[model samples]
Target: MEVMDLGILSLVPAVIAIVLSFVTRNTVVSLALACLTGTLIAGQGLLGFPTLLKTSLGSTSFAWVMLLNTFIGIIVAFFQKTGAIQGFSQYIQDKKLSRKAVQLVAWFLGMFVYFSDSFSPLFVGTTMRSISDKAKVSREKLSYIADSGAAPVSVLVPITGWAAYLSSLAIGVGVIATQEDAMNLFIKAIPFNFYAVFTIIFVGLIAGGVIKDFGPMKKAEERAIKEGKVLRDGAEPLIGKELTEMEPYPGIKPRVFLNFLLPVMMIVVIAMGTYLTIKSAKTMEAFLFVLIFMGISMFVQGIPFKVIMNTLTDGVKGAVPAIIILALAYSINSLSKTMGTANYIISVSEGLLTPQLLPAIIFIISAIMAFSTGSSWGTFAICMPIALPLAFNLTGGDVTTLVVASFAAVAGGGVFGDHCSPLSDTTILASTGAAADHIDHVKTQIPYALICGGVALVGYLVLGFMSI
Candidate 1:
């Protein structure tokens, strides 16, 4: 198929899937259909049926990405089954921290985690939800903190997942001599990432109570409080009674709390230790070190081996949808590259837009792509090739501004779309994590994202006109 033909066909599946998801409220089904469509479009007689399956499953980046995510899920399950997360929540509650304080801590921790890993959203979010709830902070607010911190902080940090991806792309395009040089360039561009900086500030403002929830969020919070209902993680309501009427899990015995706390502390200590000791090691290496620590912690906690296996299995099962989505995203990306759909889009847009307007345009385009695809990293990977090349052309090879703008657009748009799209895995996870109604979370988060995105757009426009 021609580039335009492939691009047009791509739209069909996404549109159908989105419409079906909205109508049926079944994201898993919708995403599955979209994946199938994307795979078929990619194969397009280039390979036999068996080979197509093998190609999709064996794609290097996709496979490793899934493996990493699966590991994260296993860790999360371990945290949950061992009562570590709940114990941490209890510890925070016992401290009698104010709601505002807890929220601030959540934001801070999220920012901290983003420096080390893109999985900050899940790790920081799941760990902090119980604490935030104990303080009566709304789940919507918690989601905001997690989402704001994830991509924004990652892009700002030179050694994070965002930088790694962009560096690899730059090297592939021969724009940089090596991944190291590419990373250095990204590091220098950090100050120019206006969207990320402003978004973080916006999160702080919201958490500090300077910005109150408006629109659907305000309504939902009001409704939740007035009805006294418990919101579950993934945003579904338990319904039929006041939240207090719901049975609480058995109170954490001191021993159980100690078992949980000791292991978690060990993980943190070892992760930090590895980071400090390694000096020049990759983030993944540090993650592996922490994983080792986690293993030791598990042993120290005396959590049964069978229980650990079950928790790991449960975690992997939970990640299945995300894994599938990521695989499809990768396939679609490869298809677009081969078909030149990305280049076509870039060519069409480049003529109509200028360097001064590129950031804003890229931001908007990234958001649309992310919303359509329901994957932030996929959106980043897709747009980076087109946006970076355009940025370079516009600036006559001024690498810094172009790279900064491209990175900002990818991070900002990815978060914006992920924040509001009901089809997004993070959106679903946020709803599940908060125990709020899924639709309610989507409805509530949209206004917040719009307001922040508007601010970010203006920031980008102003910055785009300024020199480094």
Candidate 2:
């Protein structure tokens, strides 16, 4: 069957997905329905389930990502099971640091966990939440700090899993001469990533007391300060109360923090180590290693092998929802691209695409896709193909600066959406990591994210004209 462009129908899947997610608050059901809608459109039939799953999960290119992400979830559960996560914050609490120092440490750890954005929240948010709570910091504040640290820092850092994936994509577009060239261009584009840079700086400023938290964040902070309520009275945390509040298993070793830090350090070391050697990433490797270590550690601590397996399963369970969401996120992106969603948007914006406005336009559109879809990687996948080619052609394939700006726009815009969208995995993980109410985290964070997003918009406009 010949598939029609469907004009605006190309966008229906994403819209339906987002609306369902918001209304139902169940990402799995929402994404599944969205995928079905798009698959039906793309295949022009009701029997596209296999095609949909293949596009989302069975694609060799994305299979690793889904696995890598799910393993991170397992590792988070491991931390919970081993009592490592608790020990991390407990170790920090031992420092008796000031409130600002604690926030600063949390912010820095987000940067430190630069290898994987998924792991960043699980490690930093989970580790720092208790310390922040002890310091009278709201869970909203904790999630914001974690969310900001996770994607923003990973996107900027060249050694991260994010960079490797993006670099491979950039090279595949045929614009760059080689993967090395793509890597260099990605590094050069970092300074122009306004949303990421500004978001990071904004968090630091808040941590340093240079800027006050306003909007919902302020109220949450005040509630924490005065009422000693880290969470709103009726808020529901994403990770269950039993897990977040669990104690070390019976006869556990002296250094619970070691259990946390060792596996975390290995994730970084292994990812960077292999990335340097083979140019293949190690997110999955690290997660598997952590899982094995946790199981053994727990078993050694007198827990039966069966119970240890249960703990491992529990960690994977935390990540399962996220992985399912990720698969659908991919499916929607494929459907949108196949349907020409980005091209449709670009086609409409043709009248507005001056050289001076290209960066800003790309940034805005990228942000829209990411926010709507709740996946920065998906936004990059959708928009980069369209944006890069446009940048290449619009500039006669000669201007390096314009290309860099466009690259920055895509990356920055994706982060902007990921930052604000309640549906984003990074945000959801942030809520779980901090043990905050998911919607509350979204509510309190939107205001601050938008503040930085506004700054990024104006900056892109200025840079666009400067490149001209």
Candidate 3:
């Protein structure tokens, strides 16, 4: 199939997707419509939509992400069933930490559970919710801490799924032949991942009270402190009623190490150990192993097979929402590639883009793309292929400072946009975990994310100029 030159028309799908997302606040519907529009614009007609869906969603990479999310959901349900999550929270509550201390602890815990974006926000928000509430911390504040710590922390580490996916993208580009090479490049880009670095530090500063809360968050905090109301009047938390009302099995004691910490550590050890020994991180394998281990462990502890199966089933059900968004995201990305959206943008900017300006421009574009799509990984899938090769060409195919900055720009921008998007799965999960209203979480978090995004843009500009 020959690629058609749609010129400026290629922008239609992404623009329509972005505009519709804001209007509907429905990422799945937005992406589906965008793909349909792209298909028609490419002259593939109505039937082309199904053909493109098969071509896009049928790939090995899409299957890997879908399965990984399912396994993560199951593990999360396992934690909930065994009461390990609540047990950990109880332990924290027993410490009798002050308001500030609870916030700081939640921040630390979020970074500690850095392996999965899906897991980190849920874990931090759920584990810290009761303690934070007792400490008079607002649910919005807790959600912000969880949301900021999730993708930001995950992207910084080299052993998790994020690292694996990002490094894999850099492969087949100039000089990034193997996983090891791409991983090395990712590490080098860390310091330049300014948005993530700033967001993480910003959360800590606010959590520790070193920096005063401002904007809507400040109002929420004051309400929580002065009125003892963790939520605004009539605020509806994003969490389902079933989750809020759930109780651990009767007569079954919770063991944090056996039920939770051990499984988490296993994932880290297997992923990190595999990367060190084999030069390839087996992230999926690690998740699969943990899922199996947890199931067997629960059974040995007297959890009936039927109950375990039910929990697994519930986990799959929970993952269905995110999986739907992910599948559509993959489809839109495929449609974008086939329609040459990235190419058109590049072609139109060829004369305007200097090597010294590439990093800043790429950062802004990637951020916009991620914000519109509401999926950091989806943004990564689309932007990395385009941004990396452009950087390579601009830098004479060397792994120069400009190239590294461009790479980091894409990673950091995706995080920023994902952090702020209400349609984002991680953002929604953060609200659910903290029992915060989904809209409130988005409203309160955006000011902080924008601050970091501004700072990151400046850093990119500086780095780009320095490369000259």
Candidate 4:
């Protein structure tokens, strides 16, 4: 396939993709459709879609991410089925903390389960829902806390699947030639991920009573305190009784350490240990090790072999949506490359971008893309390839402070948008876990998320000039 400049027209595929995602609220379909549109625009006709899929999805990076997420899903299912998460929740209940303390505890728990953004919110929301209700904490508040801790914390942690996928995307772009360099760049950009950092801190402040609630959240909090109603009157929670009320297998006792904590510890130790000794982090290997350990431990604890297999299959099934989105994302990325979309943008904007404006602008654009599409990983797939290369071009192909700031802008912006978007999986999961109304969760979270986003924008503006 020959790469075509397409001039300004090269932006058509991504633009159509983003617009279609917002209008249809279906990222997978939007991406696929956009790919077809791209093929037509590129003069490749209908056959280009298959060629694009083959070239994009048939890669080592995609395989690694797909497998990593599959293993992660299995672990999540195992944790749910074995009642380790419930056991931890029970342990927290035993502490008999105050309302503020319970909120803070939920926040901490969310950050502790930092490996998967998808897992953290569901675990924290479910774990804290009953406890928070007992303490007169609103479901809105609980959902906010759960949602805030998820993607914000996961992206900051380097030993997780987010890091693996993100760093993999950076490989062969600009100065990020190897996995180690890409991972290193990711780490170096951490401090500059202002939106995520600020959002997490803001949540802690609100949870700990250091900050007062405002907007719809304030009203919900007031209602919870005065009327002793955890949910708004007539509110319909997104989740049902069947989903919220999960139990361990018959006659099996839930052990938090064996089923949950130990496996998480293993991932951390293995990932970080490999990164320290061998430069590149063996993130996928760490997950694989933990997956095996989890299965063996569950089997030892009297779980039937058939049940274990069933849980594994369910895990794979749960992972399908994400896998499909990633596959489409890769295809679009390939399409964008073939069209030279980023190159066109760079060529068009070269004279307009200033050091003081670039990072802030990137942050705003990335935020809009993520919020509209409501998929942070999808946002990453589209934005990173464009953003990183632009950064490299502006910084003369070196991984300088300017380049790092630009990278952080994209990452932080995506998280900020994810936090605010009602269509986001983490946000919806937060509502389900807290048993809160889905729309109510979205309504209450926006004000808080915007405040953090606003502050982050300013931070980016300052850092951009300083870096340059």
Q: Best candidate per lDDT, number?
A: 3
Model 4 sits at a Cα RMSD from the real structure of: 5.7
Any runs in candidate 1 off by more than 4 Å, and if so which? 1-4, 36-54, 116-118, 171-181, 232-304, 314-344, 394-407, 410-440, 465-468
Residue 86 of model 4, lDDT score = 73
Ranking by TM-score: 2, 3, 1, 4
Q: Please give the CA lDDT of all the candidate structures.
A: 0.61, 0.78, 0.82, 0.79
Error of 3 at 116 (Å): 3.1
Task: Arrange candidates by lDDT, descending.
Answer: 3, 4, 2, 1
lDDT at residue 217 of model 3 (Cα atoms) = 99
Candidate 1 lDDT tens digits, 1-468: 344445555565566566766666555566556556655666654333345446756876666656766666666665666566666777778888886788788888877666543456666666787677656666666666776677667767765456666667666443667877777666765766665777788878877778876786676456445654335334443111221122222342334444444544554555555544653324445445555565566656665566556555676776665565455445444444444544444545656567677788888777776766566677777777777777777667656665666666766776676566665655655554444444565666778778878888887787777743
Give one digit per residue, the lDDT tens place, for model 2 in 247-337.
5566665466567777777778887888888877676776788777767776777778886777656666665555665676667666666
Judge candidate 2 against the unseen true structure and give its global Cα lDDT, from 0 to 1: 0.78
Clashes of each: 14, 1, 0, 0
Q: Which portions of model 2 show Cα errors greater than 4 Å?
A: 1-4, 16-66, 172-175, 320-339, 392-396
Residue-level lDDT tens digits of model 3 in 1-468 = 466678878778777865675566555577789888889989899998899888877899779767876776677788888998778878888888889999999999899878768667877887788788888999999999998889999999887768888989999999889978998999999999999999999999999999999999999999999999999997877654444545676778999999988998998788778877886768789889988999999999999999999888887776666567667767766676667765676576657567788898888777766765566887788789988998999778999999899899999988888788665668867876787876788888999999999999999999888998
RMSD of 2: 3.2
